[model samples]
Target: MRIVVARCQVDYAGRLTAHLPMATRVIMVKADGSVLVHSDGGSYKPLNWMSPPCTLREGATDDGQVEWTVTSTASGKGPGDTLRILLEEVHSDSRHELGVDPGLQKDGVEKHLQALLADHPATLADGLTLVRREFPTAIGPVDLMCRDAAGASVAVEIKRRGEIDGVEQLTRYLELLNRDPALTRLGPVRGIFAAQEIKPQARVLATDRGIACAVVDYDALRGIDDVEDRLF
Candidate 1:
C-alpha cells in the first residue's frame, strides 16, 4: 500500500465528471492496483476511487508537476473511467510494504456468521438446504447458495449487522443470478439477507425488493449445529 499526502488536483471522466481542486489530501494506492483519493474527513469511504483491474501511469504534467493517471477497464463504469491526478506539492509520500495479509480473522462478526450459516443453512429458513458457500458469480462470491424444499434457487447474503448496504448487495447478486439460464431453469432465484440484527430501514428496503430479511440467532444456530453433530 502506498499512501501519499499531497496538494493535488484530480479530475475523473466517466459516466459523470468530478473534479477536486488542488488541496492537500491523501491518495491511497491499494495492492489491487486501485487508487482512492480521500479527504481527512468523510469517514472511511473515499472521495473518489477507481477499483482494481486498473492501471496506473506516472508522468509529468505540462507544468512539470507529478501526474498519476489511473484507467479502469470493463468493470462497467463503462469501458474506461479515468482518474487523473496532478500533484502540485507532495507534503509526505510514504510507501509501506504491508506483506500480503492473510485476510480478516475475526471470530464473531461477519465471517463467523457466514461459516455457521453455510454449515446449517436450514436455520435461515425452513427446508432451505445449502448448494454451496462462496458461490461463484461474475461480480464476486455469494455467501451461500441454497435451495428451498421446492428447489427454487436462493442467494443468501450474510452480515453481522444488516444494513441498507447489505440488502443492496444481495439485490445485485439476485439480479445477476436470475439472468443465468442454468440457475433460472429451476425457477426464479430469490434472495435472503441474513444477519444478526437488521436495521428497520433495511427490512423495509428488503421487503420492497421482494427479498426476505432473516434475523439470525447466533447461539441458537451454534446449538443446533452441536445437536446435529451429536445425533450423528
Candidate 2:
C-alpha cells in the first residue's frame, strides 16, 4: 500500500465554522491494484476504480515523509495481509503545502507494528498477546505494549525511516519495564525496536541484551497475491 499526500493546506477557524480552511487531498494506493483517498475527514474513501474500502492497518509521518498500510476487508485474509506506502511531500503550513499530517507518520508506524504482532503471532514464540498501543511517547502514549502468557509484559518502540535514535528510547522502556513489578514478572523482560532499517547502535544493544528486535523493510511485505486476494 502507498499513501500519497497530493496537497495540504492549513485549517484555521474563524468567527464561526464557516471560515474553515479547505481540506487537504491525499491519494493512497494499494498493492492489490486498489486506491483510496484519505481526506481531512470521513472513512477511507475508495478510489473510483477499486470499489472497496481497504482496512487501514498502520500510518506514520516524519520530516514531511508519509507512510501507511491498508488491507482488503474480505474474509479469509489474515492480518499479515497488508500494503505499505511511503511518499514525500512539500511542507509550507501557509495553506499551500502539499503534504500529509506529521501525526499520520507516527500513526503509520504504530499500525505497522501492531500488524506484525497480529500477523506473526508464532514469531512471538508463544506467551504474548497485544494489548494497548500508542505512539510519539512525548505526546502521552507509548508505541506498543503486550501481555505474555506467563503474565509478563513487553513494550515495543517503533522508529520511522529517518528517526535514527530508537535504541536509547527502547532501552529506557526496557529499563522502566524491568523496574516496574507489574511488568517485571514478565522478566527477563525484552524490548523490540522495529523499523524499516536498524541503526548500528540499536542492533548492538539488542544483541547485547538478548532482546528480540526486528527490522521490517516495506518492500519485503508487499506483492503477496495470495495474501492480498484473501484479505478481500
Candidate 3:
C-alpha cells in the first residue's frame, strides 16, 4: 500500500461527476492499483476512489506541479472511468508492501453462525445451495453467496444481531453485486439478511428495500452433527 498526503484537487468522471476542490487529503494506492482519496473524516469511506484493475499515470501539469491520472478498466468506451488529481504540494509519500491479508476473525456468535450456515446453506431458504463463502465485491465481500433452484443468485449477509445498519450494509452489497457483469448473467441478485435476532424496524426496512430478512438459529444449526450421519 502507498499513502500520500498532498494538497490536491480531484475530479472524477464516470457513472457520475464529482469534484474535490483543493485541500490536503490522503491518497491511498492499494497493492491492486485501486486509488482512494480521503479527507480528515467520514470513517472508512473515502471521498472518491477508483477500484482495482485500473491504470495510473503520473506526470506534471503545465505549471510543473504534480498530477496523477487514474483510469478504470471497466467495459465501457474510451477511458471507462477517470479520476484526475492535481497536486499543489505533496507533504508525504510512503509505501508499504502488505503481501496478503489473512482476513478477519469473526466474533464468537458470528463465527459459529457462518460455519454452520456454510455447511448447511439450505437452512436459509428452501432449495438454496451454497455457492461460495466471502464472495468479493467492489466495496467488500458478502458473507455468503448461494443459488436457488431456479438459478437466481442470492447474496447472504450474516450478523449475530441484525440491526438496521446490518440491513443497510446488505442493501449496499446487493446493489454492488447486481451491477457486476459476471454475476449479472446468473439472473437477478437478491439479498438475504440473516441473524440470530433481527430488530422489528430492521425487518421492515429490509422488506421495503426488497431484501429478505431471515432469523437464523445459530445454536440449532450448530447442533446439526454432520459426523452422526456417516458414523452409522
What is the full ranking by lDDT, best candidate first? 1, 3, 2
Off by over 4 Å in 3: 77-80, 109-195, 198-232
* Residue 25 lDDT in candidate 1: 95
All candidates' lDDT scores? 0.90, 0.54, 0.89
lDDT of 2 by residue, 17-121 (tens): 211123346664555446554556666553222224455544566554555454556566554444444433533322233455456344346567557555553
lDDT of 3 by residue, 13-67 (tens): 9778999999999999998889999999999999999987899999988889889
Off by over 4 Å in 1: 1-105, 224-232
For candidate 3, report its TM-score.
0.52
Best by lDDT: 1
Instruction: Give TM per candidate.
Output: 0.52, 0.41, 0.52
Report the C-alpha lDDT of model 1 over 93-195, residue by residue, as the tens digit.
8899899789967667878898889898988899999999999999999999999999989999999999999899999999999999988888999999999
lDDT of candidate 1 at residue 85, scale 0 to 100: 93
Query: What lDDT does model 2 reach?
Result: 0.54
The parts of candidate 2 lying over 4 Å away from their true place are 1-127, 135-140, 162-164, 186-188, 217-232
Worst 10 residues of 1 by lDDT: 223-232
